[model samples]
Target chain A: MREQSRGPAFMRILYLEDNPLLAFHVEQMIEDLGYVSAGSLSSFAELKEKFQSLQFDAVLVDIDLVDGPTGPDAAAWLQKRGIPAIFVTGQAQVAARHHDISLGFIEKPISPSDFAEKVELFRSRSTGS
Target chain B: MPIVILLDRASKPELVRAELARSWPRARLIFYQRPVTAVELVSGVQSALLVRLRQRDVRDHIGQEMELRRELNHRVKNILASVTSIFEMTRRGATSLDAFTDDFRGRLRALEKVHSAVFHAAEGAVSIGDIATLTFEPYRLVGQERISFSGPLMNLGRESGTTLALCLHELTTNAIKYGALSQPEGRVTLRWSVIDGVQPELALEWKESEGPLVIEPARAGYGTRYVRSALAAVFGRLPTIAFEPDGLRCSAQGPLSRLSATDSSQPR
Candidate 1:
């Protein structure tokens, strides 16, 4: 890791989960971990409408969304756009199949420590550490 | 033409005076201790009354629209949370890659199936038999006679119906895998009866027989867990699942009144 400073500045994250309730719950956790929750959307279509204007740093996605199980495709789309993604899912085994598309995974019913550590990993990956 | 009107100083003149000046600038206006005539005084009061009513109507409309939006947001959140919970929990039992994908997708479809049934009902309630029929429809399309569903038209609340659908999904899937539906000669009988009283209760059973010999799994899986967890909340009772030599037998009973809904706040 490069010279670690208070240099890992807070950045905005986009949430891609079909459940609005989970999104609302996770948004609180994101803020608590010192990141801004850019916004949440259920479908890839909604994400497309939002992504351009959002200017977010990273993404946390679920495997199943409003548009069905289109989450892996969303992660790939984000990767192509030079934005990083992490699969936040209960189906870690399923997410592991698409490991190349995302920076890492954060299992669901998220523990604060795991979330903090994984977010740090995202921070490091984005900051080129 | 200039519509000149004199106002009484004590008759709440400032509001009307300012509004008139903005809307009809060329008109002359004067405020006096007393209007020169009662006609002008009455006229000014009437205009003020009209503005007040209009303002109130606008405020009321805005308030109502905002309330509707809030309600929509809340329902959307609840559904999302439920979906997330289902997805999270279902992953526990999947074995092969195809099995995981198929199971998760099937459960989601079950939820969707119940959602539509709830929507089609006139009230935010559905019939238990309706739930059974719709769930068993695909099977029927293939050939409906193997499974027999017998129940009177007893109302079910939307949420309870959803839970019941999920349970039926587990029951149906398990039957196809290991119980009655596995063999050509296998069969299932689903029936429910309402015990009427001051506090009504519904008694339900799922009995499968004549498939391959029943062998109990060493461990419980997603479908079984889903049935146990969802019913604990929906019916406040844990259902019994048995591995009889003939087939699997599942049964449960709970207060019927909770499943009967007259709620009408569902957004179409």
Candidate 2:
């Protein structure tokens, strides 16, 4: 659980992605969209271990991570900590069941425009403006 | 009302008659003794039961087929997503259209080779040895054997195999551009072994030598970072990459259970 936002003024997005190439691509995309990448972790266990030190305004989670299908549970855990999470996965039906915990879903084969629009939700929700 | 009553040969027929009379006072009852050839009756019942069983079997097969189709769809989508990611990353780094095209094509070929191997594999899984051979075969000089790999017969599940193949591709491309494979005299060796213990571990090493002097890059590139993250995802541990003056060495070890295709995947 995060105590307080130690993140910089700009939004720092983190990715919970097991696929290395995809993780790198998303990191670059975050920078391309003018945001800083906190980092990428492969598993929910790794996320839990590294949560404290990581500085990110929001997290993009994939359903099937290095660990099993723990994305929904991770999102629920993040919600409890008051952190925002959005699922980016091919398994939309599975993600649909856990919409209660997540902000929304970004289907796989991610379009840059779609990604940008969904990611904007996090900023708007956080700022509360 | 018409009623029919069947009784075993040994049954006391009077008792059943009286009971049926009490139950249906106005009915005309017909009584017949059990057939002496009981085998026909038993076989008829057995055939009826088997018909039901066959229907259930067909239903189960259909269910399994649907599940397999669903799984295949997920796999294809994931591969497409990986391709999308590769395209974006390659484009980001490319200085020109030619560079991007070459790099992206190389990566796609590597992906296709692995998928082919996995498709031909008996259980939709592949071995590290198979991956290494497929990845290096195209890059090998016609007359010279510059790349070599040897390991035990260990299989990787589909996802793990795909990741490893991609990592090997990145390594191969880099070696060709600047590492050992760049020079005619340079050599690369990949070796792996299983460390038997309470929990057996798979240990692997990739070393390049006899090439130009090695210098650590100021910042890690796509290949290095991809290898680190991909290996970590499969092995559940980070791999070490060292750029010694003589050559580059990448090494990793993790629980064999995690790497084995036969074992049910358990999240660590």
Candidate 3:
């Protein structure tokens, strides 16, 4: 296990969201929670390239990315790489489908507090605390 | 010449034939007993009124078939026109890659919903309930807790149903993107009623609340234009849209007499 820290943990996150307005809000929330956003991608191709080149502690994905197959597709790709991932989706049924592989789901228009809590949970798990 | 043939028993056949022969000398008269042999009679008189009746029946059947074929073709053409309009609207308005995919899917789903509703109604007149249910199902999956509906069980002709279904789709999509469905705390209410006895008019209201404060668009978008134009063509009246202080509201009204149904034409 990595060494645990009392302050915000240093972990890299890759986010995949298509909507600019929502993406902006989510990115701000991730920063406020004191986690590093390694890179945020809007398309499947970009997501794959970023995942292959860098090591991300966790990934936050939206199920309905306009150009890509879906959030599940990204999650499945990350799963193949043995990376932890969670879906932030508006569709309940889609989230349910990924229950086996995903860490959890965060509904859209994500609340700031809820985001922080999820980030902390992911960080603790990543460090094996 | 128009001729009448009556098949009855318990009457004098010879006397009736003699009276008919005396009444009109230019007319030919034939007699048959009870349980008449239709084939024998037909063979006996090649130019009999009964043969003419059979020919007329066949002609009427063919005419009705032609009329039905024409009506079906007309309906198919109208549906194609509506689909084309939606495609054109999406093609012209799509800007980015994401926008293009989302818009295309939304429009295609709208067409599918409309087609399903019409098919379920058996290509006849559909009910307002059918249109509402079909158009709202997709949105309900996303915003399950935010939407509610109330309306009488009323039927609309196929044309009216198609038009109203399209409008409902546009409204739902707008709500998903910019209005009530966008926020977790927001709610949308849909209600409908009828008015005016002679020429019955249907009115539908869509109200949204508790969402992000809405600002009226400086200019109407493609969706707004499509709704206005399509409803005008279908209803022969302009739809009313108001961006209220709380949220957005739209009302659409149209005459009910234009609806087509097999029975119960009460002029209202």
For this target, which candidate reaches the highest TM-score against the unseen true structure?
Answer: 2
Q: How much lDDT does candidate 1 score?
A: 0.74
**lDDT string, candidate 3, B125-220, tens digits:** 788887888888887778796778888888876555766777778778888888877888888888988886878888878899998798898977
Best by DockQ: 2
TM-score of each: 0.60, 0.77, 0.51
Q: Which stretches of candidate 1 lie above 4 Å from their native place? A: A1-129, B1-43, B141-143, B261-268
Candidate 1: tens digits of C-alpha lDDT, residues B209-233: 8888888889877676556545644
Which lDDT tens digits does candidate 3 get at residues A34-65? 87766456556567655556667788887755
Model with the higher DockQ, candidate 2 or 3: 2
Chain A TM-score for each of the predictions? 0.90, 0.90, 0.86
Worst 10-residue lDDT window, candidate 2 chain A: A1-10
From the highest lDDT down, the ranking of the candidates is 2, 1, 3
Q: Please give the range of 10 consecutive residues that has the lowest summed lDDT in model 3 chain B.
A: B259-268
Native interface contacts kept by each candidate, as a fraction: 0.07, 0.63, 0.00
Summarize candidate 2's per-residue lDDT along B1-268 as a digit string, tens digits.
Answer: 4555657989989999999999999866666677735665555556656666777899999998887787678677878999999888788778899999999999999999998998898777799999998988887663158888898888888777888889888987888888988888888899999999999999988899998999999978778877887787677678999997888999888888767643122221
A1-129 in candidate 1: lDDT tens per residue? 344553544678888875443554566567768788776766676688667767787899988764556889999999999888898876678799999998789877666688888877777876666
In candidate 1, residue B177 scores what lDDT? 76
For model 2 the local lDDT of residue B158 reads 75
Interface DockQ of each model: 0.05, 0.44, 0.01
Q: How accurate is candidate 2 locally (lDDT)?
A: 0.82
Which ranges in model 3 have alpha carbons more than 4 Å from their true place?
Answer: A1-129, B1-43, B46-58, B196-199, B258-268
